[model samples]
Target: MRAKRTPVLDRACRACGFSDSRGLTHAKLQSGETVTLCGTHELMLRRAGGAVDAGELRGVLSDRRDTVRRSVGGGDELAESLQEAFAPNRRRTERRAS
Candidate 1:
């Protein structure tokens, strides 16, 4: 028999632990974990901390979902590997543009 598994939550708020597939913003933490934040929580993360600013960045996997309402495939291992390989170049270009 197949082992029981819990379906992954498409969105989970890292701040308040709220979770839903809708109204969630996907972002990457400074520690590199991908987390979903609601509008309320996203605002909180943008604020300055005690002495430094938050190091989080909104991920590319977000916004398009709500803006266009399209489904995304996360099971493509080869594609994910390729993306990771070029991540450095992508970051450099982004930095230059900014």
Candidate 2:
């Protein structure tokens, strides 16, 4: 029995290492190999005579737009929390002079 191939959900872009899911897309090359790509690389592929699905490209672009919109709307709070989480340890370790 042939093993079923599972779709990769967390693949990094082939041309660039942009792993953000919001702007990532998959394309099947004429050589029958599937590749993950960021929006820029996908457009490059299309411009270089590669076939890209119009519907899929539109969906990816719309989703990316929505993500950007949400980020612009309320990303400050999340950014602050992340900053606090990754901030250097501030507790003093030296013994205080009595």
Candidate 3:
């Protein structure tokens, strides 16, 4: 006897419209189910907190609120990461203006 195959949930990429066949990858939810998404979409999901449902996602956000607050309070590594991520774009724009 063979076990049945589970279906993969298909989600479009948030950044580009690349469909599952092109760039989709899987993300395991808290519920243990997997969702298939493109690379761009996966990044978006991570930013939003991967959750099985909206309520679960909300709870994850609520649970992280304190951590976020503390990180933003001072000496945050997040600020540095954000700055590094945007610095290249800032330099490009400055070059364009000059």
Candidate achieving the largest TM-score: 2
lDDT at residue 67 of model 1 (Cα atoms): 75
Error of 1 at 61 (Å): 22
Better of 2 and 3 by TM-score: 2
Q: Model 1, range 1-98, lDDT digits (tens) per residue?
A: 99998535345675556777576886545565555677776665555221122233433212333474454556478888889868887777566433
Give per-model TM-scores.
0.34, 0.43, 0.39
lDDT of 3 by residue, 1-98 (tens): 99998784556532344675767777667787665557765666688767885446445434342454534455568887888778877777665443
Ordered from best to worst lDDT, the candidate numbers read 2, 3, 1
Model 1 is weakest, by summed lDDT over 10 consecutive residues, at 48-57
lDDT of 1: 0.56
Quality of model 3 by C-alpha lDDT: 0.62
TM-score of 3: 0.39
Better of 1 and 2 by lDDT: 2
lDDT values, one for every candidate: 0.56, 0.66, 0.62
Could you tell which candidate, 1 or 3, scores higher by TM-score?
3
Better structure of 2 and 3 per lDDT: 2
lDDT of 2 by residue, 18-79 (tens): 99988999877665567788888788777666745544434443334335353445457779
